[model samples]
Target chain A: MIIQREAVLLFAGLAVVLAVATAIGWTLKRFLAEGAPHPTIDNLNARINAWWVMVVVIGLGAALGRTALVVLFALVSFFALREFLTLAPTRRGDHLALSFAFFFVLPVQYYLVAIEWYGLFAIFVPVYVFLALPILAALRSDITRFLERTAVVQWGVMISVYCISHVPALLMLQIPRYEGRSLLLVLFLLAVVQASDVLQYVCGKLFGRRKVAPQLSPSKTLAGLVGGAASAIALGAALGRLTPFGVVGAAGIAAVIVAMGFLGGLVMSAIKRDLGVKDWGAMIEGHGGMLDRLDSVCFAAPVFFHLTRYFYT
Target chain B: MRLLPQLLGKAVTGLMRLLTGAQARWVGCGPAPTQRIYFANHTSHGDFVLIWTCLPPSLRAMTRPVAGADYWLAGGLRRYLITNVLNGVLIDRDKATRTRDPIEVILAALGEGWSLIVFPEGTRNVGAELLPFRSGIYHVARQRPEVELVPVWIDNLNRVLPKGDVLPVPLLCSATFGTPTRLREGEGKDAFLARLCRAILALRPA
Candidate 1:
């Protein structure tokens, strides 16, 4: 009954958000269709439609509580890892190790988190799995770019699985007075990260002139970064009732998340540039893939997790 | 009983698509309802399944993979997967069995209006380079002259589930179907095979 009530409230909130976004998108479409079809407005409308779908899906998962939410994030990690490895230059020698990473290592890491084995969950992929995978690749006896190949797989697992897992792992945190409400922390992180992304895109399109890193990500701009971070921080502060953090604390934390998320997006963009592929895979319309959606979240999750664990827990 | 296998087939194909992330790219020709022989380079055991799953659901029902009987029939699970789930036509790859010709079996399956998927490589290769295609494709093309022979290049499957590996790693694999080629009146066996190989290879992303 409590879970049902929570689900109802979350769904209601999401419906309201979607309604407002849809209205804005419709108005923009109508206004921008006068002369020539504006590509930016069309893309924005597409992104808003995608956000509606993404929000409903994630909101349902969050409302379902621990197990379903964990499963949802696991699937996200699975697809994100798939997108990363799809473009990454992998050899036949890396097959066994990669198999272990996807089927065994990724699942086991999430399983540890599900079972609340905090110690193992923290170190499983980074320390144990990291050392084990390179050895698995070495057994194939293909030394051609062995280091690069192994590093690609290792970094992919770390970013996609290890980092993304922390969002749901937030549900496992034993924060004082935060019982039965850790799901909100997950939502908080998602909202801030996503809001930062959306806001950044909007700001960049409106008033962007100076490029952040033209070679890495042509879309990101300095004006977008400042405005988006400020907006996300404000939203985070307003949502402080959901967490143990007060308004000012939530603002500080939100700023940290936004900054880290920005860096994460940049880093992922750099990796994509190095790999010479655009947008990972075309799973999500306008967003590319699961990794593209979660790039900022990947960097912010670990930091938010550790911060929550150290201070609140 | 029939519905069960269909459901299982859908589930298996869905899982295969998710795990392999196999994107079906129709490069040279769009998908048609006509009977076809989708031949691809074999790298991993998952080649046929990846190619089969990439087909539109309407086409999936009619497309059956021509697999080696020795491999698929060895295990009970594999046997069920090949026969029931995939609706595979298992051919005895062993040359010792002179009883029924593998091409005749494929042709019989084709006679029933089902498209056949054949791996011209016969066996899985461990490298990026394609092994010289065997004579089976040439024979099949000769037998089913009306059926379209589409060359599919299945890239990155070797890294996803390489030879001798049971557990498949979740890597991005793609099945790129090229333009259908037909056997010419004067083309030699080696020339036809080489052309088929070239067609498949051309679909690979640079």
Candidate 2:
């Protein structure tokens, strides 16, 4: 009987989510019709298509609720971490540290989030694993580039472990109306953050004139920044009901997400440039790595988490 | 089963192009060439795959890779892939005498108009220096003097997938197809092998 009720509720929820996506997609189509160029229109259409698929998955998973969604987030963290380490250089001595990072630390961090052990999830990588992995490396006694090697191991843990695990850390939030909606919060953050990236690329291609940071990211532009951020803010505001935020409050939150997302893109782009690589790693089709997709997530996850925890909690 | 190998071939080729920027180009002209021997230096596991992947689809159908029967036979997955899908000619290197010639099998493949890839170096080596030819390739070449001897120099493959490493790291590679040479009149076996090795070494990028 409860299963039937849950099934009906899931069906209804999916229908509503798809309905909203379709409505927004059509609205964006109409908006594109006014002044957007042909290629921009086509690219935005492609993004919308991808967005629909992402939404369908997220919506269905959310309908199933907390545990399933956390598993999905954990998978994302694993893939992202895998990509991170795959691109990062390692030596014979660092093999143990690398193995531990990928196999042990990644699961432990996500498991903490899964059990709603917020305190440990927050510091497992930074505190315990962070200190421990280096000691494991130090014991090797085959120390070549001891400092540099340790730093790379430490940085891999920081970027892949600490930053990425923050996404699932959303589950610990305890808002009154949004008590069971932390999964929704994660979905909202990912959608808006990723959408802004796609929109900015489209906008920049169509109307980009002044390069935002030519040296760092030649493709980025100020026009893309304004247009993409504005669109993200609007999308965030419209989807405000997913959170405890109202229209104005949502816009403010959206602004923060857009800002951080842009910074995240910049930082990741810079990291790629430093590595003398075009992409982080070949994990995503036509895109680079796990970090390539989650560049914004890395920044946006923690920012959104703290903002919501401060105000809504 | 065939579809999976073909798909895997495409994926691996695509990956090689992406990682190493190594491109394969077939040279020389021939008409349904049969009983031919392709001899090159052995550097990485990719040596066979790279050569196999580079061959024309039509030609790939009948070609057999001479893999160590020991290594390929031991691993279950490797055995299936090599013996069945890859259609490799696995031979026992350790238990074999001069009479137990793998080249005879390659010669049989040639008699059936199937091309064969053989590594002159019996083992994988990292250095640029070509190891002494095992005389098996020479024996094959001598037996089939009519067959076109394609000298394939696989450069930087040692760096791409180095010795004792399981995972392949991307490094720029090139497979140079040098002019075909045959055993000259009255060319001694030792002198002939030396000349063939030098021809392969000459194909290295200056």
Candidate 3:
């Protein structure tokens, strides 16, 4: 009987979310059709389509069981890490460090979250993985590009493995009044973060009067950033019950995520720009790379994870 | 299970195309025939992928590659990928004593109406000059005189993705299909192998 009630709630929750997403997507679809950069607009639509598929898959997994959902997120982190390293300049000396980062650190980070080891989960990547990887790389003694290579591996490990894993770590939270509603929290975070990206693209196309960083990232605009971040905060507060937060608290958290997400996107864009490439890898047609999709999550995940743990836990 | 593997395949192929923009050309797909032995000079790891990705999907089904058994058969994942994903025929090249005949294995694959890709240089060369041809190509061709011996020249593969590198940087590579040649009656093994090597070298752009 409880399962049936949960099922009905989940279905209702999903229908509402999907309907809203579709409406927003439809609005953007119509808006893009009017007068947008043809290629980037097409790419944005394709990214939205891919998001729809990913959301459905994860949603179904969550409805099935918590473990399934955790495992799905784990696989996504693995792919994102793979995409990151595939582009990063690597050396033979970095192989062991890279392997350890992928096989050990990634699994352990998620396992910590899965078991609700909050404190260790929060610091594992930044503190431990960051220190250990360079030591392993330096052990090779082929110090040609030693500092640069170690930094590259360390950065990839942090951004791809350690940071992104926190999003799934959200599942282990035990929020009051939201027992077994962790999936909804996941949805809320994803919806706000992804909606921000989609809306930023929409606004950038519609009324991007001022450039945010003409040299750094030409696509980003100050107008788009403000508009998108505002909408995300508004949506975040509206879905505050999804977390252990009230409306005002939720807005505060969303504001943090928006700022962090912008920084994350900028930093990753700078990295790609330095590497002299457009996209990280072409896994998704419209989206640039795995890093491109996960850039916002890299920043948003850790902040959200820590905030929820600090107050709720 | 099947659907998952198919999706993985598509995802992997898509990833490859994404990293390296798809710049494939199918100008000369040569008519469907019973069997043909493709001999090409290998410069990089991209040689196999370039050739395999270039062939028609239908023809790829029956085509098998002669990969070094020591490397391809090293572990379960590699074995599964070579035999299942790529449908390769592994050959042991480091036997100190006489073992199972390699020619018989390749002949059997061709006899089953499967086309095979062979690297006559036997090993990857870091330089532009074609490595010395091995006797394996002559032996395989001598046994299957009926099969068309097509000499393929893969240019700029080494520059696209060098050997022993995990990441493949995007660069244009062209696989030139030279006119098919066959072993003449009473031709010596060294002469035939050299001619085959030269036929491939002839196709490289100046």
Candidate 4:
């Protein structure tokens, strides 16, 4: 088979789950909410519909081989960066530098990852872009809020570009007995993390009583986090065939991914609060924005990449 | 054939939407195809482009951006973009050199059933508030009281691609299309322009 059997199984499993979810969402909308509008049900259905599109796109990328997957992620990084920077406060002085970040720095980082130039991809944004862009901003000579501008541009590149690139960088890992199956690592990380997110939302909507952090995210609860992480850990253990890790090892890493993904959500929520906006933009119908979808992955990808590189590679 | 220019036009408009998001919030009105004079505050040169980009394709084809002949006809690329791609109406801003009255030219476009996107501020205002609207808008409204006057507020464009900048910072800009206003029965020139300016300002994102 051109694609791994496990990957094909994962795709089929996702399609069936989404189909059932769509059915349930439709039944709930049709029967439960006869008079008053149901916000939660409508939101769930919209999310599920969007998930169908996303799953198909990712599945296609996985089937098309590594270059296609890398290119797909490159476009994801582009949209994610756009959403992050759109809400971020910037000045006219930052135009040239900002252009460099978008046009030059973003593509170069992805290119380095595609070519597996690990030495440069790891530090391109953190070292070179961090050092150089501020110089360009400084040259414009608008010193009002200079420090904030510099920090934000650097942070956007880091979170949106550098960190998100780590997902594709997983393909560059040299693990024994994992030849021609590196795509599965990405599939595994995505499945575990995203399942954790969905589980958290479902658990929160149903059994959640105690708020995890009422101020950071109103929707999250302690019950949601605990229930979701436990389920995702079980899921990861079951999918051990996809990874170099055994069931226990996969379960441990799933725990780490869930924790990091939770932190990533909180941090991004705090940023939205600071920006005084709901969601990043109207890019996505119900999911808020690209950044909203990728926030968990942004925080989890780098740690997962490094962990796999250190322990298994 | 002008096929290349038309294709380039689509690509450039798409690029503009991609950069600024050019989201049209039809708060006070729907995006119905009607003969309306869409007026907005002038900040950057991209103001009308953003407004034009926000229109529905049905309205976009009939919408003509009102620009100054002095600028659009200044050179090669700008002239080509303004004429072929945007299909803009070049008004003679200079009273001294213009043979045709700017209001007549605008009314002519309206007579031909084309909607016009006009920046009523006469010139770009880089300050905190809008400049006093040029009386040309009031004249257009007076002449064509039948045509609806939609006040559009283009937010954050100056911050995105302000004057003297070639590349934009890719900020999220929105064009808030307020309820269509018309010159009242007894409204004077200054009063009508003031009402229009206030309407545009009211739509600014809080």
Question: Which candidate should be chosen as best, given lDDT against the real structure?
Answer: 4
Docking class of 4: medium
Candidates 1 and 2 compared by DockQ, better number: 1
Docking class of 3: incorrect
Worst 10 residues of 1 chain B by lDDT: B160-169
Per-prediction TM-score? 0.90, 0.68, 0.71, 0.97
lDDT of 4 by residue, A139-225 (tens): 999999999999998889898888989998999998998787889999999999999999999998899999988887999999899
Winner of 1 and 2 under lDDT: 1
C-alpha lDDT of residue A303 in model 3: 88
User: For all the predictions, what are the DockQ values?
Assistant: 0.71, 0.12, 0.12, 0.66
Quote the lDDT for A108 in model 4. Answer: 95
> Model 3, A182-278: lDDT tens per residue?
6666766777787788778778877898999877689999889989889889988977755668899989988888888888888988998888777
Q: What C-alpha root-mean-square deviation, in Å, does candidate 1 show against the real structure?
A: 2.9
Global lDDT of each model? 0.87, 0.72, 0.74, 0.89
Candidate 3: residue A236 lDDT (0-100) = 85
Q: What is the full ranking by DockQ, best candidate first?
A: 1, 4, 2, 3
Query: How much is the lDDT of residue A267 in candidate 1?
Result: 96
Q: Report, in order, each candidate's fnat.
A: 1.00, 0.00, 0.00, 0.65
lDDT by residue for model 2 (A1-313), tens: 4433544554465467556756765676678565455654554455455555655666666667777777777666666665555455556666667667766887788788878887777778878887888898887775788887788778867776777778768878888865555666676677688778877987887798999899888989999888988998998887776667888888898889889989988988887787677777554444555577778878888888889888988
Q: Best TM-score goes to which candidate?
A: 4
